[model samples]
Target chain A: MTESPQGQAPSGAAADVPVAFQDPSYLAAVVDLLGAIAYGEMSAFERLAEDAKMSPTLADKAELARMASTEFGHFEGLRQRLADLGADPFEAMAPFEKPFDAFHARTAPSDWLEGLVKAYVGDGLAADFYREIAAFLDAGTRDLIIESLADAGQSQFVVDRVRGAIEDDHRVGGRLALWGRRLMGEALSQAQRVAAERDALSALLSGGVDRPGMDLAAIGRLFTRLTENHSARMEKLGLAA
Target chain B: MTESPQGQAPSGAAADVPVAFQDPSYLAAVVDLLGAIAYGEMSAFERLAEDAKMSPTLADKAELARMASTEFGHFEGLRQRLADLGADPFEAMAPFEKPFDAFHARTAPSDWLEGLVKAYVGDGLAADFYREIAAFLDAGTRDLIIESLADAGQSQFVVDRVRGAIEDDHRVGGRLALWGRRLMGEALSQAQRVAAERDALSALLSGGVDRPGMDLAAIGRLFTRLTENHSARMEKLGLAA
Candidate 1:
């Protein structure tokens, strides 16, 4: 059977919600956006846990576990928000699952350092994109999105580990650069897939009845900023962007 | 090289702590006990995250992830305590790796239900044993241990899942009963191994110069209580003890 279109509201206690969300499409779009972030957090948690498996030291493992726990923490916040918005959080998260799962499966890190780079670069990009989207959202949701995007100082941890590994062996730098680029590419591809499939999300991005949003040119600038930040992150790790 | 005995205080800031913890041996033992629980929490995090993979639905997966996050939360608290006591948390947890990993391996669940049962039953048993050991500890350490063992209401989730499964198919209850028994047995074996290997921990339990501890009868009763609790838990899942 063909999959249901994204942002089609799942039946639940959505009727009594606020005026802002009363428009069914706005509610669906918000649910879709929140769902995507929720799935992203869960996937991040799973990937981070998997990454810990390859940690060379117990300290490193603990670091990865800490990141995993923090991602799960954000996940709870998003899931609750989805419920408060009157969507069943799980059903809300369902549409984006295939894309996120596929991204992780394709980019499964072969070793510890690569896993660290992916954790940092990939999540950094996702956070950037979400922050941009938050600009077009309501104050409450935008704040929640921004709050959930807090990296908890994890980027520095990844930078230190990755840079330390590169210093230990200069040759490691070249391989990880490729790994970082691939992470960006795969992440973008999956994200594009999500954008194409999720009409409500696209509508939210383009502009809604009352909410202001990014124009095509504005979005292009946003992409430029995202790419620039990704490069800057790679540079921080002593790698070529 | 022979593995260092569990609870051997590594040399460091342990030099000038509290008067009680200043007894290097007592310090090592407490660090060791905290380390054991810390490693147990990490292992539990890993195991719960693994169990989440088999979740039949996104909601179930989130429930497992929430539990995993809570375990890591406890782990962070214990690790901080270890550092406060002047031990590198990793080195402290190192001695426990083999036993906890082995216990998890032996009791690895064959399916989702088995994993849930292991999570609820195995962790319940470990918490009971730790609480028993906590009775012999200093107030600070004892309080930390008790705090770390908080179940976060996970029992009801597991019980609901397991009981619902049993109701769906009676045969499931019989198999889960055996799984629960295996989890209990493996847990006891690992706990015995830890006791035999950690001299300071054993000394702590048996009573040191100033510390009052479990007499042989008290130890026997502790075992009786742990077993009774396990039986009660199994009964709650609609399985035989």
Candidate 2:
């Protein structure tokens, strides 16, 4: 339920503090997480931009595609932060190749609405998790994280469209609600897979001096918060909870 | 060769004016071009960002990946401009999908150097063309085109790396140069396909107004300029003429 303290140095005099970057295990975990998120941002932007072409009108199309642009900004910030911490962004992202790839493959959207739903649900959880951990980071890194999670511009548009569709044709909301649920399920499944397989990252999450006291229970609680937000978002859009 | 007029208006006294939004036919052609370019930008960013991981150090990785970020910004500008012109970005892009897709498919990079070489040659020509077209466009649309072409940040980085690699290993340049040549050839072939198929776009290139004293030879010269730029760029990077 608590934020990961991986971003902090061990408590001591400044000179005597054990820098997390100096610890190979810690660096590896952080790098892995950063890479996963960075690539996620990259792929997310590409797909969203591509799907924007599917919009029925120019205004909606531009609005939808512009949302993807924000992802690139986020990707750049994460990439630079990773580099600042002595990690290669691409290499750091490589270990995430399989799980994230699988997650996207399994949840490939079949329509524009599905794509929007994925962006809404997937990016929402990511921003939430990043926002929490960002609280524990240095001012610069935390600032970057917060800035990256700022409004995606299309959120209101997405809500309006979804709500309008629900109002005009009640049957559509049920399908999209199911789609939203599946997206979350795949995301959580991938999160667990990554945590279980990457021990350095697992240790950073569960065993670090800075991250002490965090456990699977915390992750579960995080997911609970994410689902609560997702439900609220759906209700706001006139979709079934 | 000659600069393509921005976009033709639908009808009325303002018919000759170069508006950002054109008739559906002209809008379709512009979107076709922009879509192909946008998709190219998206894919290039993904590939180059991934390639940056192959770098030996964090600084190098960040530097390389940062180049990819520039393309995202260009993509955003083009998408927005498409919207301003009342063109559904995706629909405008859909018609040219096959050729563009085929070009990238046949020329997928086999390594980091290969990837860089493609960007260096491929984007160099694209920038050149966009620069020429900017002259014929209305101020607002022209400004967007010029801004988009101002810097191929990532492409230049790739060129720098490619040049360095050639310097380090003389033998590598020859092979990369060949790859560069092939990429340009494919690109030109695709360009011809687009020109031949999209009449409004071709008409735009031929000079839309049919002015009494219009110089068609000037258009031929424009193509010459693009070719010359491409050759100079390739030679600078140690690619064959």
Q: Which candidate ranks first by TM-score, i.e. highest?
A: 1
Q: lDDT, candidate 2, residue A107?
A: 89
Count backbone overlaps in model 1: 0
Q: What is the lDDT of candidate 2?
A: 0.69
Best DockQ among the predictions, by candidate number: 1
Question: Which TM-score value belongs to model 2?
Answer: 0.68
Which regions of candidate 2 fall more than 4 Å away from where they truly are?
A1-33, A46-65, A135-140, A151-154, A164-170, A198-212, A215-220, B1-69, B78-118, B135-143, B160-214
Clashing pairs in 1: none
Worst ten-residue run, lDDT, model 1 chain B?
A: B8-17
Off by over 4 Å in 1: A1-19, A209-211, B1-17
| lDDT of each residue in B80-179, candidate 1, tens digit only | 8898887899999999999999998898899999999888888888889889888877677888889999994356888898999999999999999988
lDDT of 2 at B76: 77
Of the true interface contacts, each candidate retains a share of 0.78, 0.09
How close is every model to the real structure, measured as TM-score? 0.91, 0.68
* lDDT string, candidate 1, A147-236, tens digits: 898984246888888888889999999999999999999998998999999999999999876778778898899989999999998898
